[model samples]
Target: MGRRILLTCGEPAGVGPELAVKALGCGVDFAWIGDPRHLPAGTPVAQITAPDAQVPPGHLPVIRHDFAADATPGQPNPVNAQGVIDVIARAVDLVGRGDFAAMTTAPINKQALKEGAGFAFPGHTEFLAHLAGNVAVAMMLASTNVSPACRVVPATIHIPLEQVPAALSDEVLEQAIRITHAALIRDFGVAAPRIAVAGLNPHAGEGGTMGRQEADRMRPLLDRLRAQGLDITGPLPADTMFHAPARAGWDAAVCAYHDQALIPIKTLDFAGGVNVTLGLPFVRTSPDHGTALDIAGQGRADPESTIAALRMARDMAALRA
Candidate 1:
């Protein structure tokens, strides 16, 4: 399977199937990994025994991970939660074996997964990391649609805002920076990546007048990494990082928390942002948004993010290949 992407059906009761249907004819080679019955009515679906097999034009090539219940638009079925989790695991297994170049997962509802399948992870990035044998990973949100394309990674995610300071240790920041740097070089084709790390406080602790994490902890760590020949900058003020000129200064920005990273990117390119997991053995990406249960099957769900995700997977896979 040359440059093939395995697209997982996330919350099937939501918009995953519709996105899968729309993702076709986008010039990306991919196969949907989910039960075809969950797809929208009248969708032309063809089941292939193996991932490498081809499907006719205008037909979705499904790998057929069966779900326990029929999907109802806008209402998640807890009984089908196990199937969603299993589908993700199956995609990781298949992609990890190198049969597919990369994997593009649709959005999944964490609450639903937790209630239905007793899921324990915060979100897809963490879950995927566990499936990949507990490898260290960084979650990057990328929007190639924007000029001076924005890529961001949060060192601490899915935690309370008040808990961020304690969570952001020297080790966590270093790991996030290094993983993001490596991904830029390997998957993003940046030979020498320039990374910008955001501050955890207001005005980056205002030169230690506000908080000392910047000068006391962060600066020393960044200095050590820079000495090792990495092009890294900041503890910069988060408010000043996303402007066009500012963004042009760095290849990627490593923020202190989830909102710090996500707010700007989502604000910049809400419709086309792709969630990428860096430092995994294989390439993995998903829509930056979540399962849109409010508008699951009304055909109002925008497929731009899903489409961008698939294309990005193909491009990244090609680079890796």
Candidate 2:
């Protein structure tokens, strides 16, 4: 069994709870791990003691994690930061123990977490990696609505553009490819994952005219992978790779930096993208977007991403099973 899926409510001050409430009957069964007070008042909720506990029909099953105080619609209280982080750790512990199928996390506020708990780590991906004994992981943004699903991995993420060139090392690119490749097979059930890599420079260095990273740094690694029987097309112009016809050729696209990989997917399926963390020992995914503090308690949060994430987790769990 892949275990039962659990939803780790992210920043309670944000739209995490709202999204969780909206996800009640989105065609999936999962326990929500967070403070019940964070949910919109009057929202139907069934408190459960564990992941496998029976849930009342027509209600969201919540494994309640109490917060320091009641959440204010859009005002994030630093007092609740530790509680927010605790929810994630709780889900990880359960999932790691094989008691949960997978965890679908809502968005988190990094600043709130840091200011409140001295939490260190860029975001969920790195933090989760640390909790899992520092296991390596890659962030993948996948379009849930798109047929064939546009999936991408940024080789160097959460780094400044100025730092990208120096950060895009051969080891980094190789790990990203290896992890993505392994996940495609283990989690997505893809027998042969064809990958397309984007070049660092305009037009893929245009034979070194635009930039040498593609020609000097990238091509050789791709050559080695190809020699190892990995199907890869790389050093290609990033500008022309995301179109439907181009995307259809590859199962996933690996880009040199963050925006190169995220922009296209977010633009194509803004509300339906699922942020997946590959290379983890267990299955994990989250909504592609961030904590929307401005619209926290408005009941206006879009549930598409969260719903899609739940469905994706279920499918991945089956594949893993």
Candidate 3:
């Protein structure tokens, strides 16, 4: 049998449902995990018709989770936060049970989920980690066509910049590099992954003139990974690392924080980037962009990122299978 993918459309009021519908139209074997009512009424798509529907062409298979209220574009309700969590939880459960081969999540609104549902984690990567029994995972954003195919991970995520210096550690950096290298070989099918580690300070601390984290914290970790026979380099300057010449040598770049890594990729290919989670037992991927609440129901939601996510999820699932 072909691998099954669980398409979890996140916040009802957001563009999740629309992106789900659009991806279904592309003819992938997947099931929708969301409220069926949110779908345009009477659409001629084949859905599993229940909580675990098989993919039906010109129709969508829905795993219904009825919300207490209807969703309007550009408006979010805190009351339905649990519903969003439920969709993700169920999708994870299904995949864990071997019922689904992989999962591709639509973008969700963090503020709404927190205020309405009391979700504790800041974002999907952390929340999914909790759902999966606190598995150690890292978020990687990947784009294929952008010269050298960028894949990035931040040592410190969703935290204040001031805290980054304190958070940088040899253990954390090592784990991130190990997971990143494994992801390249497994998910991306790179035989020998060339990794570039970005420095935390300007000019790689200008040789400790700006900061010592690069020499004190990062260099040792890179050295350890190299001794283990991993093809990795860095403590390289961040500003010069992302351009064509710098990217041409590396398969993926590991950065010290979120913006350092994400800014370049988002700038290079915001519309087509795919966010992949490394170190998970099962394949999980999402669009790099978020739930466009501002354009939620304007029929203006671009499906490009979502489409890229679905494709990446499918490829990863195939590799794992």
Candidate 4:
């Protein structure tokens, strides 16, 4: 049997509704967690006419939630922020309660969500962590051979650059490694995963000329993990770590900071990157892109990233089940 995937159309003004429509059109057994009224009128929806109504092809199953305000393409209204949070909260509840197999989320605007609804947190990963009762998690961006792949987290996230050195601790690095290792084995099905760790400073600190974080902090954790028989490498130079030749040798690369990992993957496949949250009890995946309010309803939004996210969510659900 196919998994029941729950898709949360995060921000109504963005491309979420359009992507949901497109994915349903492609004939996936998924339910949309958002306002049905947000969908263009006359859109084909796969609503069960009765409790036992048979689902048909070319129709989307919508679990409706109404937005308080009307959305315009290229325009973001803070008033609808709570609506975005509500959709995600509902999907999370469904997944945690085992009502759905997995969830694929659309992009959301943090600023709009905060200003409109008083949401606190930098982005989805943090919000998910809070929603899950503050479980630790890491973000990974994935792509096929045609594009670059990367998984990243700073020893500290959402902190100012000056605070990174103080924030980089041995305990945090070890936890990140453990979470990443588990993700490779369980979620990705890698029998033995090779993980490469990037250094915090330029040229991997140039043997302390650049900085001492690698030698003082990161290297010790890598050595400990290696001693435990994990297939891991590095404190490799971040600048040289992401090219094809380097990435070909490893299953995943861990960077010291956010941009260190995200820049490469986003550069390689901006339109198709899938942001996967590692270490979650339930399967959750999202597009790497954000809600593009400027082009939301213009009908010009590309569905590639959302499509990738849906496919990934489906695969992860099957793997978990």
lDDT of 2: 0.91
Predicted candidate 4 versus true structure: per-residue lDDT over 1-321, tens digit per residue: 335778897888888888788676544467887877777667787654222235676777877778898777667788889999988988888788777788889889888888988899988988998888899998888874243355554445667778777776887778877888888888878789899988888999989998988888788889988999988889999888777787777888877777777888888778878888888888899988888877777678787787788778878777888
Model 1 CA lDDT for position 248: 97
Question: What lDDT tens digits, residue by residue, belong to model 3 across residues 40-120?
Answer: 556455545344454444777676777777787778888888988998998998888877778999989999988997889
lDDT of the candidates, in the order given: 0.93, 0.91, 0.84, 0.79
Between prediction 2 and prediction 4, the one with superior TM-score is 2
Output the better candidate (3/4) by TM-score: 3
When sorted by lDDT, best at the front, the candidate numbers are 1, 2, 3, 4
Candidate 4 least-lDDT 10 residues: 46-55
Q: Candidate 4: how large is its RMSD?
A: 2.2
Residue 291, model 4: Cα distance from true site in angstroms: 0.5
lDDT over C-alpha atoms for residue 292 of model 3: 84
Which candidate comes out best when scored by lDDT?
1
Candidate 2 backbone collisions, by pair: 3-101, 4-101
Q: What TM-score would each prediction reach against the true structure?
A: 0.98, 0.98, 0.95, 0.93
lDDT of candidate 4 vs native? Answer: 0.79
Count of clashing residue pairs in every prediction: 0, 2, 7, 3
